[model samples]
Every structure is written in C-alpha cells, then in structure tokens.
Target: MRDRFLTGLIGYPIAHSAAPAMHEAAAAALGVRVHYQLIEVEGAGRDDLRAMLEGIRRLGFAGVNVTFPYKEAVVELLDDLAPDARAIGAVNTIVSDGARLVGHNTDATGFARAIAPLLASAPRGPIALIGAGGVGKAIAFALAGLGVGELRIFDADAARVARLAGQLAGRHPVRGVASIEAALDGATGVVNATPVGMLPSRDSPVPDSLLHPSMWVADAVYTPLWTPLLSAAKAKGAKVLTGRDLAIYAAADAFELFTTMMPSTDVMANAFDAVMAARYSPPA
Candidate 1:
C-alpha cells in the first residue's frame, strides 16, 4: 500500500456506526493499514457540509461515506458525480478523483447485491418500499435493477416520492402511493428505509398489523440491526433481511472505491458482527 491512508464517514448520530471496524479489518486482511474515522455532525447545514468536504480534500483524506439526511443534499457540493450517483440522485460514497471530488451511489449497487439472494425465491409480485429519502432512492433504483416486477413507494414527503417515481418512470413500474396502507397492500415484501427503528428509537415505519406471514421484510436501519420493523415482520413469520448486509456491502464498495484495493467482504462481515455483538456485551 502507498503509505497509510485515511477514510471516514459523515453522518449525524453516527456513534453507532461499524464502518471503522469493518474497514480496519478489511485493510488488515490485505496487510494494509487504514484509519477509518467517523465524522459525526448532528445538525450540519449545507454550508457546514461544504466546509467539511473542502477539509476532506485539503487534508488529503481518501474519501468518505455520506449517510442519512446528507446523502441527497451533498450531490451538488461535489465537483463531479459518477453515472450511478447522478442517475439515482444520491451519493453515499464520495472519492477524490485527482483534484475533483466525485460522488458515487454504492448504496444502490450494495443493496442490489445484498438483496438479490433474498428475492430469488420470494414472490415476484409488487414490492413495497417505505421512505423515499437518500437511502430509499438508492434502494428503489436497486430494486429496479434487480428486475422487480413492481414497486409501490410511500414517503411522508410526497414530493420526494414523486421525484423518485419520475426518475423510474420509463425504467420500471413504480407507484407513488399516498399512504403506507396503499404501499403495503398485496405486496410481496416491504423495505423499511426510514430511520424509525434505529437505536434509541423503538418506532417502526409500518404498524404490526400491516405485517403478515407471507411478506418478507427488509429494514435499512442497522445500528440496532434487529429493528422493530424486522422484529414485527419476523413475528408474523415473514422472512427478514437485516440492515447489516447492506452496511457491510456498501462499506466494502466505498473502501475499494477510495483505495482501489479489493477487500474481503467476508472479513468485513466478521468485523461487522463482532462490533454489533460487543454492543450488548456486559462491561467488565
């Protein structure tokens, strides 16, 4: 490796993130050293985010993972956006390409890679996608790429769903539903992309009544891994997918993009699990 490199994540309430553990383990597996810092900013506005990105470039940091509310907003702050990021209208991984900061949407590719196996044997009927924000948009595009038959999307901000629907207009069959009930109606599976079930929050996007034994559930909140939404769905006998898979795959993709080094996803996955397990470990 060319000396030691620095990478990071930028998001609010990110104290629960496992990016550092996963990245560090992957680098160690490759005999390379890295420092993956978590840059947590609770209420950063556009100007604050711009300054942060500027600092990343000036400091010569490899790249950073953009998360939560900032992923969609950071698109305009970058010098250039990769084809996937531009198409999805979101950026989860931002790398410095020479002098320009280039944005990429690994969440889309990562979600697609993580969810494919789960959907293989499940019903091909319409799937319900909750939340149309940054991660939601990425998942929506990922579903389309997976060749899902139909997607019904719902978000509290109707305008966000409308824009996401518009983006996938000719690409896939998508409906911008008005209510969560409409989105989950007769769907094959449901994806909770909202931050409702994250740590310190017990809320779930869909009420327990909406979940049934036939539907498979996927939640994007991995801080707690076993989100309430996934729990409710599992209680109903629905096959559940954890946010951990998406987190690991997405982090691995970002690491490779930043360092041009292929990493062992298996090693990253082990690191992810160890961190999550330690969260509940009794302190000595």
Candidate 2:
C-alpha cells in the first residue's frame, strides 16, 4: 500500500464538516499518511460539478467522500459504480484504482453499522424517514438491508419522494407519504435525513405533538449533534441517535476504502469529538 495518500471530500457549503479531522487521525493511528481536503463550493450547477470531478481525476486524488447534494449527482460522472452504490442509487465515496474512478455508497454501510445496535432490541419496521435526497436514499436502502418491515418516506419535493420510492420498488417495502404526519403515523421509529436541524436552522422537521416515547428518533445532522429534532425526541423519552455516529462510521468506511486498511472507530470518534469541540469553541 502507498505510504502517503491524497484524498478529499466534495460537498456544498461544507465549511464545518469534520471529515478531514476524522480521516487524518485514522491515518496517523494506522501508521500511514493522508492529506484530506475539503472541496466546497456554493451554487454549483451540473456543469460546475462536472468540471470539479474532472479536476479530481487530473489532480490525481486517491479518493473522495461525496456528501449532501453531490452524493447522487456525482454518480453519473464516475467511471464505474460499486454494486452497493448502484443498488442504493447514490454514491457517498469514490476511489481511484489508478485507472478507473469507482463510486461507492459507504453511507448505506455506515448507517447500517451505526444504527444496528439501536434496532437490535427495538422495533425496526414501519419507520418514518424524512427527506428523500441523496443521504435519504442511502438511509432508506440501509434500513432495507437491515430487514426493515416497511419505510414510510416523506419529502418536501414531491418528485424526489416519488423517485426514491420507485428506486426501492421490488427491493423492499417502501412508500412515499404526503406529509410528515403520514409518514410518522403508526411508525415505531423515525429518522430525520433532512438538513432542517443543521446549523443555522433551529427548526425541527417533525412537530413535538407527533413524537411519542415509544418511538426511536434519529437525526442525520451532526453540525449541532443535538439537533432540535433529537432534543424533542429526548424530551419525549424516545431513544435518539445522533448524526455523529453516522458521520464517524461513514468516514471510517471511506478511509478504509482509500487506504485499504480499516481504521479504529474509537480513535475516529475521539478525532471527531476534538474537531467538533474546536469548531464550537470560542477563539482565544
């Protein structure tokens, strides 16, 4: 394996992502070297994204993690897609084998690992999933892989919701609901796959009235790990899962793909904690 690896993460408005810290710490712990870059841009249309992917190839980056808006859009620009990426219809990680750019969806695997224990003794089926974009698709597929009896999905974008439901057709039990209430009704658990509770947005996607202590609630926004949604869920005595675990696991999976060596999740978690603390700390 190469001693030094150059990798990065591609996403929009990613001024605060802790991915670099997590990956670099993992590399150091494993006795390898890695330089992780943040390729963030604002208002990037399709053409701009194409140019960025071309730049990655030309710059000879080992691999990159795709997030948010780019995870789904980047799939078409890659030379090939791993089986899981194709199945999930999204790409969260991309690697270069010196010849081909292969897209993979580590979000699915990461989420599976992160949420597995939560579902181990709890109800796993008939869950409500908010948001239907890139990460949402990966989460839906992950839930399916975990043998979720059914997924009730809702998205503000009507067309996007339809697209996701269609993709999961024949593969698992999924249905696109008209509203958050529809998705949460009779559900045993709920997951917030949207960016509603992320930094700069303090709103909860689901109303507190809709939440119950019997349900387990999860949010995929880690910027403020304790999102408004999770807070409300906690207030209701519902078991909550933070986006922090998801972020760590996903980055660890990507790091392994880039370095061909698995990383210690505990070390990655420590790195993530340190970075998050610094990001929120006041300048001295």
Candidate 3:
C-alpha cells in the first residue's frame, strides 16, 4: 500500500474555506502526499454526523478539521479529548489513532499565536468579545490564558454568552453583557467571533462609530479576508488583525496533529495567499 495521508474539513457551507489549499501545501512542503477534501454536512442531524465520522474512519482519514455548528457537537463523537479541548468545551481538530478517534482544540492556541504580538504592548484590561459559540469559546479561553484581565462577552443568544462566561470565569473575570456597547465599555481590544461579516452579506458585528483608534480590532471571518469589521476598524485608525493569521495557525497545528510532524507554516501561508488571489482576483 502507498504511504499517503488523507484529510478534509467537515462543516456546512465550506465552499469558501481556504483549508484545503493550506493543508495540501503544507503536506507538499513536508515532502508528503495528502488529499484534502471538503465534506459539506449542512442540515445534517446527529445520526448523519455519526455516520460521517464512521465513514471517515473506514476510509482511513488521518484527521479532519471541524468548523462552525459542529465543533462542539463533534466532541461527543470522539473517543478522547485533549486536556485543553475538554477544558474549552470545543474541538476544531480530530485525529484517528488505529480504532480511536481523538479530538483537540487548535483554535485556542491558534488565536493566541495570531494576536499575541498585538496584545504584548497593551495593558492587561478588559477585552470585548462578540459571539459565544464554538469559535468564540476557544478564543475566550485563549485570551484569558494570555492574561486578559477581564472578558466582556456579548452574543445575540444571551444564554450562549452566559454559558461561555460561566465556563471562563475561573480563569478570568468574565461578564455576559446585554449589548455590544456594554461589552466594549472600558475595552482596549475588540474581537468579532461571529459570522456576521462573512460572505454574501457585508454586515459587520461592530459599527465604525463604536471602534476607536486607541483600540485594536480582530475578526474571525476570513472568506473575504478584509471583512467589513476590519475595514471599519482600519478606517477608524485602529490596529487590525485579520482572520487569515488565525486560519493559517490553526491549520498548521492541525497539520501537525495529523502527520505527527511540523509543516512549514510560511509555505502554508504563501499557499493560502495564492489561493485567495486566484479566487478573488479578476480574470485575465
């Protein structure tokens, strides 16, 4: 049998994802062969998810990246969880070990790596975070571990925000605020963890008026790269962090989990940029 690895991403609406190119390029840089596919699982029920996981195992997938809607749910289907994944209550990466399926959360580490430089100079104070779902939960834990003194979380679903805040309270001072304005109050760094600024619609979670030049802003939406929130923050003269770095770092971590080897992240990043340019640039 040929020695090659197989992997893919599991998510609804994954047509716009850049993961395939990023991982495949990393595999190339590592001098290994990997086939990455997109397994769109929109409208899938628990049974469907279980069946899909079974199919992945039968097909000998090295691992798969979980995104949106399924990150938390996938935890229940796994045989084991990494300590951090269990603590954060989400899994963005899953690895297959013989008959065992293990889950891990690269999002937390990825977010920390992406935004550490920006937070280095800023004082330890309140950080405003919007959204409390899968990706949001991971980012919250990451920020808390990075020494964010306070976390102000807001979500349209108050219950989600409250739940996330409760989970994070032991590590950092967390508050589930009722409104975005309340979350931003006394905040020096702002993060948009929701899907508000993704493709199709150009809406941003935070308005330009709410952003200040003194604050640093970040968004988790990367399909468009320059998301509406990032644009508004840039216009307001605020330092901005795009979702691109988070995507790259997360995928790099997942790549290591799958292959048990470190891939050239710089090569993966260049591949992501090339893919984006090919998709977004005007045709000749």
Q: What are the per-model numbers of colliding residue pairs?
A: 0, 0, 0
**Where is the poorest 10-residue window by lDDT in model 1?**
1-10
lDDT of 2 by residue, 211-261 (tens): 998999999999898999999999999999999899999999999899899
How high a TM-score does candidate 2 get? 0.96
- Order the numbered candidates by lDDT, best leading: 1, 2, 3
| Candidate 1 C-alpha lDDT tens digits along 37-90 | 999998899999999999999998888999987998899999999999999999
Global lDDT of each model? 0.92, 0.90, 0.90
Q: How accurate is candidate 1 locally (lDDT)?
A: 0.92
Candidate 2: list runs displaced more than 4 Å. 281-284
> TM-score for every candidate vs. truth?
0.98, 0.96, 0.97
Residue 223 shift from truth in candidate 3, angstroms: 1.0
Checking candidate 3 for backbone clashes, the offending pairs are none
Model 3 Cα RMSD, 1 decimal: 1.3
* Model with the higher lDDT, candidate 1 or 2: 1
